[model samples]
Target: MAVVVALGAFLMTLFGGWVAQRVIDRRHLVLGLAGGLMLGVVGLDLLPEALSAAGDDLFGVPEALLLFVGGFLFAHAVERLLAVRRAAHGAADWGAEPGGPAKGKERVPQVGLTAAAAMVGHSLMDGIALGAAFQVGGGMGATVALAVITHDFADGFNTYTITSLYGNDRRKALGMLVADALAPLVGAASTLLFTLPEELLGGYLGFFGGVLLYLAAAEILPEAHHDHPALSTLLCTVAGVGFIWCVVGISGG
Candidate 1:
């Protein structure tokens, strides 16, 4: 059942990348909605479950929260390293010529590949979460699956966009997109081989919540608003949150 639910996410991922290739005008709206859905999942679903599962405190703070902070900082540090690497390579590729277009096109593919790869890792974790949730209970599993399915569209969109934006060839970007789509299925199946401790599962859920929050705020929303601050895009974000809320309500009941 968990694998079946994960398939929905896989299909949504493909659809998202396909839409990205075909549609240019409403890209911002799509991104806004994706960001909102991620935010909703973290706030409305993952956090509460993590807190419930992670009982007691660690160093006077919730263990799950500590893990959350760690996840956020870890992602930040990795992104910083990637940025520094990109800049150094950019300088090397283009030389120190002023007014040059920074013809660092060769370096761009590496940056895109790195970012997309990270997203694929994240998607795999999402699958793990789905399988682990089912271990806890069916209702919990369904809720997590729903969240994963919706957020996956954003994952695929970002994977393709990041790859292409960084000068990766269309073929390479599409290849990464396909890999991202398949990652969750692999993750879910892996869970059938081993079980995670409840506390550990909570920690992972909290950590992933932080990851989703960071991606939504740092990557998706900023890009959504960068060029297109249209009212419709903003509305789409709100609608995305509302949609998740409705889904959660229905699934929970």
Candidate 2:
């Protein structure tokens, strides 16, 4: 039953990806909205849940918060390392070439792929949470599933946008989108065999949240305004955040 309900998330994700593909021409708007959605998910959804689940402290701070900082630093370090390696290997001509495409922005395809992969992992966790909720009761399961399905649309949108933003091919972006869509189902099914530890899940969520926040604040938002400094893009970002807020409110989270 849990797995069956996850089909809703799968379909919603595909629809979201389709919407992103349709507006491929408005690159700035897409990044702006994606940045907002990522920020909302990290702040309003993931962090609160992580705090509740991983209620441990290290020194004077919560473990989840500590992991959150670690996650941010880790993402930054990885990006820098990748950039350095590419430069050393003579592959770092990341800026626009003369007389090339008009939107010749710097892109790091690997970073995009990594971020999308993290989204997929988070979706898988969502499915696991769905199945676990059902184990408690149908009402709980339904509530959790509703939250997962709604936010998953945003997840799909951000996944595709990030993948494309980093210079990955359309085919690769679509492939990642598909993987993300299917993750919930696989995660739900896996729960039939075993349940995950809550503390571990919380820690993972905290870390992933940091990575996502870094992408939004450092990468996506700046890129959105780099070329086309428009007010509509900023509005789209605010709308994106509001959308998630509405979803969380409706879900009683």
Q: Give me the candidate number with maximum lDDT.
A: 1
lDDT of 2 at 221: 80
**TM-score of candidate 1 on Cα atoms, chains taken together:** 0.85
Candidate lDDT scores, in order, read 0.79, 0.74
Where does candidate 1 stray beyond 4 Å? 84-100, 103-106
Q: Which ranges of candidate 2 are over 4 A from the true structure?
A: 1-24, 81-188
lDDT of 2 by residue, 1-253 (tens): 8899999999988877988778544767866877777777678877787787788999989988988899898877865754522322222233444554543345568877887787788789778877776664564466557556765776687678778777889999999999999999998898788765888767766776686677678766876786778999999889878877876777676
Per-residue lDDT of 30-93 in model 1, one digit per residue for the tens?
A: 7888878777777887788888888669879998998888878877777686673343235434
TM-score of every candidate: 0.85, 0.62
Clashes of 1: 0
For candidate 2, the 10 contiguous residues with the lowest summed lDDT are: 84-93
TM-score of 2: 0.62
